[model samples]
Target: MRKLKKCLLVFISSLAIVLISYGVLFYFNFFQEFVTVKDNKVQWNNLPDDTFKSCYAPKLSFSSMPVTEISQTSINLLGNPVNNIKVLEKAQRYYIPLKSICTVLGFSLVKNNSEFILTKDNMNYILSNTDCIINGQSYSLRGNLIFYENKEYISISDIEYIFNLVADFDMNNKVISLLTPLSNSNKSENELTDGKVALIRLEDFSAESVLLSESGQMKFKIIGNYLNSQGIKYHIAWVPRYKSPSNNIDNDLLSNISIENVGFINTLDYLINHGGQVGLHGYSHQAGNNTSISGIELSHKYNSSEEATRSVLENAIDTASALNIPCTFFESPHYKATSKQKEVIKEYFQYLYEPNSILTFHKIQRENNNLFIPTPLGYVDNLDVSSIEKGLAHPTPGELASLFYHPYKELNFINFSKENFGVKVDYSSSSPLQQIVTSINRYNYRTIHVSDLKN
Candidate 1:
């Protein structure tokens, strides 16, 4: 009986050791799953995939009528006349030879088996029949491909959509003008002759009730004071009026930049005296039942007409001028403005503090009499450091590394060390804004104001 009891005790001890060993191994694997050390860099594992999602979808119906070759049309590529390419009209849609357009754009076109591949820089477009694959993503073409004289032809609309170029058709003059937002040649003499340039824009400063609060004022002061101390120039996108859609406030609430609001206007004056320049963001920064700061002020849904857009710009400019605030630039709220609205805005302001289009690079480019200075580095939402780094890495020589930041998010900027899944996450005390400025400096980009850019 004693011998049997000894054996049972030994067996139980061994079982307990095995269970503890298994638990330790499982815990280690779980910890490693979340935190990984790669190439001397610590990164969080199992994060969401950061692949680019295509906003474009295939058109529902494609035109398949008989083709009518238009021989008398004049082709203009980036304001330069092209003499070799002829336009084709099918079902009232204008099409141009793919190879000729590619040649002018400096993109390579190669036929691979049954598919035609078009490539330029990092963009790859594969064309097979009515199907199109851009950058490894499949989409449907709006019109059927035509083969003329052993060359493939695509519609002008497709060219604009795929290549991020603008196409203007003149029916009377038989002219089709193709324009890109950025041009390597014919650069403006007043453009940034310095290596690369960086501009910082502060967004969503308004007279809203929330922004007028003590907390809001403190946040703005912090950002303004920091930038001034660094000797960095920045632009304040100020909304002159605040209208709340939720409260059903139809009347406009003025920003009250006068001496009556001593505290707020004083802060503004201080910022201006330091290194801040004001830009007219929008008159109210909202349309109809939309709230300020969150709604688009000028878009197809509201204030889209040329007359209405002109009225808004005039009102905004007049208001700023009356306040003695020098606003030489205009930025559409949420960067949402129609083509007609942009044209009117260009007439009102010397510079546009936004991109010419969604696909255009963030560079200082001129159109007619106006200059567009886009924020290519984007904004610091939730302090996305990786995205800002990616933007800084992508721009070629002579491009702008501009970005914006919301002063209200200052409180969320804090350093902390927390353990998740048994791995320590040490967040740096440096804010994304500071990191961006540091990166820009490291890249040897000279910071400049939008007013300094010449058209």
Candidate 2:
């Protein structure tokens, strides 16, 4: 009996040691950092896959565009936006290549003698060199079917009518704006949320760029105070380190792996405190340069495949875990991640900031079962003035004018001064961030931080 008692005590001691070890590892994030640092990365399945699950605004897609602009909620398209549009001239009217629109816009076309028949989304129309028939109805047009460059050209204006598109031609600017209406239900949802959720993202808040300097912190403080003065909540993305995985740990991301200086910790605390909330901006935001991971984009650093993409994310998550940083959402540096990589990131993050989204009028785009919200105002670089103007006039009620600003800047929002941050904007009046702020306020867009979306 005494021998059995001794054996039981030994087992109890072993169990206690194991439990204590796990606790220590968790507190220090030792296992996440050390193991991953040693190339033993954590798997996405090991982490809890929890994110915000509520529905978002309307989504749009396109083939390409001449220039990027602010995201707008409008008659959204479905496919990549194409930059080059082919058009042919006819009797006093311009005819666009039928094949171009057919392929890009997903229309079905059938050729029968001088008459042409086309169908899309369950409707059919017939056109000839002189007349047009829609489903059976006849309509006269100033333009007609013309053949150019071995391809058929038709007055896109007529097709636009059939497609239920309203074109606003700015003769002064020579700009063509296509408008579409949302369903009553979708419009209701959009009106309730437009511009309500204002996201002031400080891109690359780590050692990779300039956030560590006094100037950078000053810029951060300026924006935070501006938001606070405006009564707005916001989000900040943090990087664990700013170099390759093999590089020695530095900055907020990998600080737990090593105790950082008081000044550094103070800066980090200031950023965490004054900033509305925190998120993951990728660890070692270096792309295509790290020997450990080899790609130009941070998410693609591991390689060009999905499996390699996931492992890179594993590196970020595990490192963040070690540091006790709650990475509620994710954004790629320079918006340089692949769709496959985004899927892998989706498995880890709740929401994603997608600037390089394959869509037009960059609104909240839902792809791969994940809500990819676009930063239409540029990454604190090239602000889309046209996109912003369109959103101001969007037929939908809510306008998510998600604006991105880096501390380092050649400004886009016109006449941006310090005092204007919190003031309500005049929707009819034109201004940079102020217009957005006013729109948010007027639309009842409850200014919210990204953390608000985290479940």
Candidate 3:
């Protein structure tokens, strides 16, 4: 018994010494925090041992497109910009401050020692270091409590389960969206896809551009093959570039272009037969009798009133019917249409995929009134192709994966500056197919036609 008591005393003394030593080391900054972030490698180093600790980081990367940081991308807190709300990345996980979440989500955090309470709609949320206690029950979580720079942060994963919100992390675009329950199920009877996708690619098919030479035919074949390879039942918006040309027939050298009406119809027939959903872009894609915006045919063409827009649209429909082509939907030339024109269009057409916002037009509204499906991915305006991924900045579901390319790129083409769309571009390599595939995979788009996205 005496020997056993002596052993216990020694063990207790040793444990006390170890504890004191640790406290001293911690007090003197001996266990300093060193964080190292490298490509696909994130480490946390501490002093005394000086050993780097590896974290469980899942491989999250985007292919073919550049990886933008979260800070660089805009995060929507409840579909509005909340400057106070911020996200922090550490240990390969995202953390949001408790205050920011409360402020943005319209809740108050009741603070307690080692725990915080949130009461909203009569239910109480008790958040601790490891569990989110609701009422009297505790739910387990990983990295639920984080302290950085003396401020408390909760894992983004916990926000939805605790706050009745949805957290969408766009891996490709690196944007985060914390949305209300309404933002997730914001679908009318006509708003197409359940969530996964509904694909629509605008062909910029203009009456100004429907030429049927060997090059034109070959380019169409290429687009068809690309779509087939992607297994995308692609729907194309047919822009009727049907302006009466006076002296613009400088295609003597280019066999890809001809003023012959027969070849153009033949090409249209080919598109129709090959799974093309016909839609009028405009009756004429030239802003006739207007000097303010020259090429915006639908915006200022024939007239600004609804009747003229209706007349031009009806002309296109009549032309489609006369040619035995299906005139199902309408898209604006350059997504340029006034509210009055859109009203006229929605009256006649079953659906119209219009731009939420374009480069030149910033004031365009993107409300999903069910008639105007917001065109998310606008025109693929650059040669790098991946530049179009900017549309994923606000990654929402059921949006029209609307993208268009000028077939003129197949020939010697024009390039635009990164900033200005109106300025002409001289040279840029064409990689439209690569960008399209990247975007499709990144967003998990299920291709469909405008008419197909019905109740």
Candidate 4:
């Protein structure tokens, strides 16, 4: 009996030792494996010492690549870290299942390429090697085929394309719909004829934005030259009352301009002398955002103000009298006009630049018995190719290029004297406007300003 007890104790001690060793190995992730597969061959990179420092093993598994695969150029459904390739060359390019690759890299299938590149901010990524090279450094990857099911595959270009679609999200208030060409529409009976496009501007309410202001001037000059070169007529979005009190370059430009300049005394004189027009933007260009405005809404929406709320019209009329220009046209600041504001605005001005919220001219009469022509204006807040493309792709055709813009590097009386910086105001480079100009010139487009209408 003594001998038997000693043997049993020895066996128990051996079992305990084995269990302890297994536990320690598992804790250090010594069993963890990294996987990589290519051309029917599977390879793995050994896990780093830190991967399994705890008790849990990483969940590693694989899923079969179902669809047919093509050459290395073909995208694998499993996407990046592709471990397998199933060749099916005849499949339509769109049907290639490369969700993994597309989802990882944000690209689309507009064109074909051997390898796709991802560039965001300053980071650069190359998908072929399953390596993330950032700032000239490579980070080793641990997994093979980024396994999903019992089967493993690579992502590569296929996944990159899908991600491209996701990143190109469209979020904006603008909508495009086809309408009859201007030639088919009835002309406006007023001084400013209907069907004639107009160029309107928002007075940069902030005085601190001088860079933006100079930028705006450069934009204005560019647009003006384009219109003039094309022989297209246009009108300026001027607020005489908003002019700087100083006799600076801005004032001189305003005083010498031939089109409608928004203001009080000088505007009235210009209108009287040049057979020009006067429009009401707002008193002090108003103040507010989506809500909180005390004035007649220039947009089609109704306002809650007594003068549509703030008696904005009363203030506007008073300002006009003070400045000497009769307010005949109404435009919303930032294009945020309300219904009540519209009704009240009509009491002061004879016409209003149509708001985009109204889909068609027919829709305008349904909203208000008055005439609201659809005069679309391009709203540019920044210098970009996309913005310029929008202007050209959808110009008013034969009407004015009523482009609305704001340029202010800083508000106040200074900064306009500074050079336009390195930013090319003219279309000497690959500017969209230049592209449009080249296109229109090639096609022979005749441009005209709104004030040039014969009505």
Q: Considering every candidate listed, which one attains the maximal lDDT? A: 1
Model 1 quality (TM-score): 0.51
lDDT of 2 by residue, 1-455 (tens): 99999999999999999889867754443222110101112211122224435222212111110111112211212323434555433221234567666776677888898777788876787878756787787755434456555877655345444554322222233233333411110111222333334456655566433343333433344444444455555676666566555565334433321111211222343344333566767665655545211224454444458766665566667654443344667877657787677766776665786643543224554444455666654532253345544554452332245666554442222122112112221122333454555655564545455444422
> lDDT: which is higher, 1 or 3?
1
Query: lDDT by residue for model 4 over 1-455, one digit each (tens)?
Result: 99999999999999999889867854443233312223322222321121112111212111221334344333222223323434231111112233333343443322125333555555555543234443565532211123233323433212222121100000121111111111101122222112222333333322122212323333333333333444333333344233332323233221232111211122122112222244556544433332212332344444455444345555555544433333445566656766666655554443455553433321122122233433433544344435444554564222223344442311121121212111222234344344444543443333332222212
Q: lDDT tens string, model 1, 226-312? A: 565555668999887777868965433233222113224434544564468999898889888778888888998889998888777
The lDDT values for all models are 0.63, 0.47, 0.50, 0.34
Q: What is the lDDT of residue 431 in candidate 3?
A: 60
Write model 3 residue lDDT over 292-376, tens digit each, in one string. 1135766644457866776677656655544334566677766778867776665665466664333212111223333355554
TM-score of each: 0.51, 0.44, 0.45, 0.35
Candidate 2: Cα lDDT at 184? 16
Clashes of each: 0, 22, 7, 86
Model 1 RMSD in Å is: 23.8
**Which is better, 1 or 3, measured by TM-score?**
1
Any idea what lDDT model 3 has?
A: 0.50
TM-score top scorer: 1
**Model 1 Cα displacement at 218 (Å)?**
3.4
